[model samples]
Target: MESETKQSVYHSATYHAAGEAIMSFKPINEIHQHLCAFHVYSSDHSRHVEAHHYCKHLSKDFHQCVIYDSDDPNARLIGIEYIVSEKIFKSLPPEEKKFWHSHKYEVESGLLQLAPKSLVPGAATDIAEQPAMLELHQTYGKTIHTWAIDVYPDLPLGPPNLMMSYIGDGQGPPAEMVQARDAASGQDTAAKRELRKGYLSSYERVEAADEWAKTGRGVEFVVKEVPLKK
Candidate 1:
């Protein structure tokens, strides 16, 4: 027997489908690309999350992704990542720059790649294009994960945390983590690393971005006493 909650959920889902059948979701419709990468907290690189990005390309200068832990139907919507061109990253205020992390390391290192196109997770023949690599190689991302799956697995407790990318050699995710990501995604990080050699190596990095890696400083949110706005 279906529980009341389950029955209500089915009804609500049907209503949502009916609404979706008529409505034009311009933004959602615009999402055409998928990517998978690993992210670590700015304050703690040892902790990591596998980020599955279903991205919408808003413009040449900006793109944003709704991230999840996996591509499974029941995957949790972990958070979002806002990616911008180098020019846009440079335009940010000094204080604002700390939150955005650079992609050069992730790209050149082959830790980031386009997700497989087919339904099969580890199927071959899904190749990442160089054009995609070129665009992301120099971009910056501001990511924040609302759900702390690494900590409180059952709940999205605590304040949201900013995420950062590994920026240099010897600072990447653990070898085991990479292996697991590879196994799940059918990616060859080693081969990718070799193939990506000299690609975008000459692209100058935006110094202001990835401040945590640059200066060992990062931002964190904390509750404070403030009067509520009327």
Candidate 2:
């Protein structure tokens, strides 16, 4: 009697209809474009995380990138980075603008890189030298890194950290870290630095999110005095 009841439910009209509905629905897979990889540091510049960006171009002036910890099969969702042109950036309110960071140093210094899995040796240098990247140089990104994979490698811990783009000279990830990445990916950052010299003029350095912390504008920083016990 139990077997018969189970068989009746499996053969029911509602079950068949549900299965048919699921089979008829097609997945939308064309909206995402796998763009590149970026090595990002926290706002305080204490930790570094490698992010792979899969972007969806919303319009000519804006793009939304979904950042992953890596492109491997076991990759984890790390964060999201939103890119906007200078026109859109300027349109934002003063308080809203404080959350975004400019891409000037990231582009000129060859810190923000394209995924090497999709490129051959020296190809990234050629791509960076193109006029297209110059547009990115003027853009701003607002990134929020949810997973603290760098500090807590075993698992994500604590609250989500607001990530910022590198703005100053030698402020990006360490040389050894970047060099090791380049070796595995077949990218030559040193050579790309040379090729990107002429394009430096196109980069317009803008105020970054980190600066907001200093002036107590957008996000307030509070200090607590703790007594030292001997």
Candidate 3:
């Protein structure tokens, strides 16, 4: 029997229905300590429970609070996400700090493809005209990185705009793909895949949701304390 607790679902291509529960996290600071010990974050317990649930899925805790600081104190809780697990935090490579920037550009460009046929025909045409090398680098760079990681299970690579279009394609031709190509070429046979573990200490200015479009804090992130729900 289905448990009384409502289960959240994430969209995936492999399944006709929901894929899995969305992962979440919370802070590991005083507020979290208070809540676990006292069932409150210096604010109303009911309001922030949902937000807490969201982060709890990611196996972290909320630090300050976003719920109580809003103009309407009684509003359902929201908070700036801080304090991720060491596993996720370390995933942000010091050398690859610019990854998010490149990824942002790549994602934005891909989204443009969804516009009407008349929109930016020149841009699309340029992409279509670009040499095979440029297209491969731009399209499959992230996939290569993802695949190189042993910690993550294999992932599918297809149209960037649609991440869920295919699966079981993780083992394809190496000449046409970086991950497969690297594995096949055997240039770095001894190069062990990096283990991914760590939290994302970066702050995204807007309230984050499950959509891919919601990443990246527009400008330099200003530290802000998210209060608990009232």
Candidate 4:
């Protein structure tokens, strides 16, 4: 789904570096976490998209991420995801809650993880990553992918699709899908599944969120017709 840049003249890169030196990237500079996960379209569960989330904490209760199809330098910007704490999510109207999905299954299942797997189990990096993963387990996320890169490889087409996280056993992506990520990132989702059982054992799902898990259907957008101004 990714390819080397075929056309370039280095002019843009030169100006980009110049801007970096003269201008301060205040907001984006705060990006502190790199997370990688799989997102399936809410409207069609069959479409699985691998996402790399470069995120920042906007406030105590909220986080936002810019998603990319790959970690490569020229990775295409595919979507955006917003994560809100349970306190924030609990206040939303029932209809609004239908669009957000829980992070518990993704966290515990190891379908979601901080980027760069630990070379050694329980190393400093692993210790640092554990709490972040646990915190995410309690939050809810709403993701939308503007680029249908998996199908329309050359260009993004169609409306932005609301994305959802996996929640149940046997609902995860296929073996080959998992294999591709593990091969690239040195991760073991199966091992992570067993490792997290002890920490996440006491976790409980919130009834007001992840409406898709309760109802078999998901939220999506469709073209609507109306009279234009005359």
Candidate 5:
């Protein structure tokens, strides 16, 4: 029964953003399925959250965490919690960094605020080495900057690294143009149809990877308060 309630709140909490009437709203088992696919929970499933926007909301109640050697009995979970008062992420002092040197944990903030509906997709998932069905870029004046990140749970094995792709305005690439690219290199899929289903094309990939990393098996998942840009 407790599990059912958790699922209900997760769903209604999401519709609050879609501007759908919530008066008679109720959670459905399908809610978990959607979250599993999107890796984020937003008002509308179509919009992706941007960097500044993501930081603003997620910092309110979320945190950045690290996971250490799970095989060791004394492993720890280190939290780089949102320090609103400081306007910067608060991490354990240098001494604590020693322990954080190794581990694997993810953004623990709830879905309500971490992943917004106004930015790009794949905030927490890895991208393929091959051409993407869609290539999204942000324009800053006449210069077009491509903001891309690889969102895989298991990775190069270290701290998270941010990656970027660039395209110029006018000459900039189409956001939805698809090309042949290797998708099997990672745990995510390569199907154009499956990739483009939600608000953001690559949402399912990220969500699934995040879930597998945390539970070792696929489980309904959600994340909040992760910075879109460093």
Candidate 6:
């Protein structure tokens, strides 16, 4: 009788309605996926934090994404990334532009990928090889990581960290990290690189963001100490 009552509750209309309400929070227009790695600014480019981004095109020129540590059920909310077209990027002030990073190396080296089937259900290919990826290959991203889950492991421990993307050859995440990610995702980063070779000719690398770093005008490292509120 107890098992019957439990089954009745599980199949009740009210229970199903509650489940539908929870699913309603996902926005209907989120259509693009960007899978990539971000390096901790303070880590001297040694640690690569994986980010799985589901993005929505707010307009023809703008996009916003919420990044997760992974795509699994236990994935953690790690950060947010914003992207803009080259025209919009040029309109920004120098200081604002410094906050953004170009996607050239990320796309060309196959460091940036599309979310796998585990995350997006049917999206396991070289995102760069897709027609939509052509536009993304030209876009710029500005990302801020709020949780240092790689270092803290259990909880977010401090203020948000300014993350940066790899800029050139040999600057991307370590080979072992990429290998491990590929093993779990069942996707080949090297194969994706081969698929993107044709794109290399037409893709124009955005150098303005990196230029700011060379001039030492971008955000530099700083330490802050504060007391936690009770």
Best by TM-score: 4
User: Against the true structure, what is each candidate's TM-score?
Assistant: 0.87, 0.73, 0.16, 0.88, 0.16, 0.78
- lDDT for each residue of candidate 3 in 1-230, tens digit (9 for 90 to 100): 24433232222333533333353332422232111000111111111111211112233311222221112324333233233322333455653322222211212222111111222433353343233213211221111111211122244232111011011122111223333322322322112111000111222321121122243222222346798899
The residue-level lDDT of candidate 3 at 165 comes to 9
Clashes of 5: 17
Q: Model 4 lDDT vs. the true structure? A: 0.84
Q: Lowest summed-lDDT stretch of 10 residues in model 2?
A: 24-33
Tell me how many clashing residue pairs each candidate has. Answer: 0, 0, 24, 0, 17, 0
Pitting candidate 2 against candidate 3, the one with the higher lDDT is: 2
Looking at model 2, residue 95 earns an lDDT score of 71
Q: Which stretches of candidate 5 lie over 4 Å from their true place?
A: 1-52, 57-159, 162-167, 170-174, 177-230
What is the C-alpha RMSD, rounded to one decimal, of candidate 6?
A: 5.1
Residue lDDT tens for model 4, 69-162: 9889889999999999999999988778888989988988888878654334334445567888888989999898999998888788877889
**TM-score of candidate 2 on Cα atoms, chains taken together:** 0.73
Which pairs of residues clash in candidate 6, taking residues 3 or more apart in a chain or in different chains? none
Model with the higher TM-score, candidate 1 or 5: 1
Off by over 4 Å in 4: 1-12, 117-124, 225-230
Residue 54 of model 4: what lDDT?
93
Weakest 10 consecutive residues, lDDT, candidate 5? 136-145
In candidate 1, what are the lDDT values of residues 115-202, reduced to their tens digit? 6434343223224456788889989999999998999888899999999998888986888988987887667787777777745557
Could you tell me the lDDT of residue 199 within candidate 3? 15
